[model samples]
Target: MARAGLTLERLTLEGAELVDEVGTDQACVRRFGVKVASLYLHVKNSQELKTGTAPLALEELADRAADALAGWAGKDALTAFADA
Candidate 1:
């Protein structure tokens, strides 16, 4: 059965943390606190998680930049984004 709250986003974030903590080779479903064979439905292995985290990281950075630049424009926005 599918876990009640399991989703790609949570898995991606978890994978990112796992990779950061233990490196990609060690970032497996064990971190989910279960055997988690079902995790294969979302990702085949750690390499997929590593690749998946890239887009998540990019999106987060984009969102933060947008938020930080929400009130600025032109050179000010560029500077804020650079500083961000």
Candidate 2:
């Protein structure tokens, strides 16, 4: 059985973390503490995990940028968005 609380979303988040820690090439189940077989249940391979993480990162970026741009305009909004 899959480990308690283990899910694809968790794995994807961990995988993104691994990318930040090690690099995309090293993002894997073992790096994040999971069995290869278990990871396969959610992702076809490490590449798929990496692909899945891209959207997560993009969403987070969009959220931060939106928050930064809130209540601002013109140069101020541009600066905030860029900083975000």
Candidate 3:
């Protein structure tokens, strides 16, 4: 059954978190307390959720890299990126 107050955006975000914690397992739907059909209303399937999350994860990594590289240059920037 669909839970009250659930939204597609929330589902997507939670799905992303789930992926980070447990990988691309479709069985993670059980953690959401909703049927697989319910998830379809928000995402096409587990693969779609995984696909949608990849860009977000990449963007976050890019942001962290940018922050780490800020005000640094040459070997320092290289070192920062490596550490980050």
Candidate 4:
């Protein structure tokens, strides 16, 4: 069953973390659910799920980098972005 407050965006974020924890080749819907079918409702398929995570990861990383770079610029922003 879907979590009490789960949303597509949240699921994508979690999936991205799962990929980082595991490896992209091993991060499938079954990694998050008992059955592949269970993930159909959340993602179209394994390929789509992985595709979803890519943009989500990029957006999340960018946001964190931006937050870390707040009130900074140039070299500081570069450091923050690199650290993120």
Candidate 5:
């Protein structure tokens, strides 16, 4: 039900930035310059947007952890993961 110019990926990225700026409490559809009705075409609501964005952030974190720990061992890997 997404609009022609909008997609879930774009909404998720924008939602993530909104969450960063004002925390989840203030990341509303208006922040993305879209009508509430239009927003609902892509996401059921603000909570759904946040839900979709969460896994993207987690995946990015995991990738960074993997890269940071690539060839390190033991304490070094632990330190790298922690630092990442």
Candidate 6:
């Protein structure tokens, strides 16, 4: 059962990881009973689950980009961020 206090942000991040590992189609609410129930405690349904995953991926990408760009400059930062 869902703990009731879990936030959508947490679930979204988890869902995104799950999707990346096993593909988004397998990350279905109906396929993951506990995850589905827990996720629904935050999001309305499967579509919203995917919606949540998008921002999580973007945030991760941005964080990686920042880390790659840190302490770097000119072509180095540009190439690192771009390659990342």
Give lDDT per model, in order.
0.75, 0.79, 0.75, 0.70, 0.79, 0.73
What's the residue-level lDDT of 47 in candidate 2? 76
Pairs of residues at least 3 apart in sequence or in different chains that clash in candidate 3: none
Q: Write the per-residue lDDT of candidate 3 for residues 8-33, one digit (tens) a residue.
A: 66666776787778775465467777
Query: Model 4: which ten-residue window has the lowest total lDDT?
Result: 25-34
Full-model lDDT, candidate 6: 0.73
- Looking at model 5, the pairs that clash are none
Question: Which pairs of residues have clashing backbones in candidate 4?
Answer: none
Query: Which one is best on TM-score?
Result: 3
Angstrom error of the Cα, residue 64, model 5: value is 0.6
- Identify the runs in model 3 with alpha carbons over 4 angstroms from their true place: 1-3, 25-27
lDDT accuracy of residue 81 in candidate 5: 96
**Which regions of candidate 6 are displaced past 4 Å?**
1-11, 28-43
> After superposition, which runs of candidate 2 have C-alpha atoms over 4 Å from their true positions?
1-6, 25-31, 34-42
TM-score preference between candidates 2 and 6, better one: 2
lDDT by residue for model 2 (1-84), tens: 657776777778888887778876355667657667777876677777777799988998999998999999999999999999
The order of the candidates by lDDT, greatest first, is: 5, 2, 3, 1, 6, 4
List, residue by residue over 1-84, the lDDT tens digit for candidate 1: 776676777888888777668876345568765555778666677567778788877887899898889899999999999877
Worst 10 residues of 1 by lDDT: 25-34
List the candidate numbers ranked by TM-score, top first: 3, 5, 2, 6, 4, 1
TM-score for each candidate, following the candidate numbering: 0.55, 0.68, 0.71, 0.59, 0.68, 0.61
Give candidate 1's TM-score: 0.55
| Number of backbone-clashing residue pairs for each candidate, in the order shown | 0, 0, 0, 0, 0, 0
